[model samples]
Target: MHHAESLYEINDDLTPELMGRVDEVIQRYANRAGALIPVLTECQKIVGYVPVELQEYVAKGLNIPGSTVYGVVTFYSFFSMVPKGRYIIKVCMGTACYVKGIGEVLNRICSEFNMDVGETTEDRRFSLEAVRCLGACGLAPVVVINEDTHGDVSADKIMNILDQYT
Candidate 1:
């Protein structure tokens, strides 16, 4: 989608009350250079991601320069530039997990969904990510779907775990 359209599309998920809150925030710190962070925090809360166009809108709304907003957003990893999927799949690639046949598990996921790490599916139903560890070394070969953790997972177990999200 076009970047301009993407900014307005954020309103689709944001309630009128939330948008009003965003407006209030902008008005409150319209003149402060440091207001960029709070404004972004509110925007991210209302819309899960902070796309480039939204950054521009926030800058314009607060009479701040676009570069100022862009700089702050890019500086933080918590602020996502791209849209996130409803289900976030985190595969543990830590040393312990990797040694325990985690490679096969990762391969299975890549083949099944045709997706690589940091990529989301076409339907936007799932986003695949690989993390260093989930602190479940005991449960090596761990695959986390959102908050739920699946440990000692095998290629066969992947389907059962994914079915929960669908």
Candidate 2:
């Protein structure tokens, strides 16, 4: 876990460390518009998810509207307002997967981790999400452990899969 003080490294009043790093990134790009994406990406890395304070900081640094920055941040599916966990556990709840008893699998995972869909563990070790489709209907009732896929899974299989991760 990061100490509470460490968070100030990114969100505090433009420390020399932060200014030096963010400014260097902004200046590297010939156009401010070109720097937008990289600036947000770098900021996310520094502060976990993009906090409102960081959004204002980024706007001032890039000389863009804060609303504009917020819009871009929220527009992208990849961007998250909340910090993510170490492992992303996506249960396929699409029609095919659901039909094949995906709900039972989801319940087992939620029960074991003591978390609901879209929630990360307090330790930030694992996160659960439900997706529309993983494009593996043949592998119905699928669960993706990060990038690797496990097909035709049962509730009991989830425990074993989680063990591999821990």
Cα lDDT, all candidates:
0.81, 0.79
Q: Which stretches of candidate 2 lie over 4 Å from their true place?
A: 1-24
Which residue pairs collide, candidate 2?
Answer: none
lDDT by residue (tens digit), candidate 2, 1-166: 2223354675554345664565566566536557777888876665556766667766766778899989989998777778778789999989999899999999999988899999998888889999989999999999998898999899998889888986
For each of the candidates, give the backbone clash count: 0, 0
Considering only N, C-alpha and C atoms within 3 Å, which residue pairs clash in candidate 1? none
Residue-level lDDT of model 1, residues 1-166, one tens digit each, is 2233444465454445555666777788788867888889878876767776667778788877789888888889878887777899999999999999888888888899899999888887889999998899999999999889999998888877898897
Q: Candidate 1: which stretches are off by over 4 Å?
A: 1-33
Name the lDDT of candidate 2: 0.79
Which 10-residue span in candidate 1 carries the lowest summed lDDT? 1-10
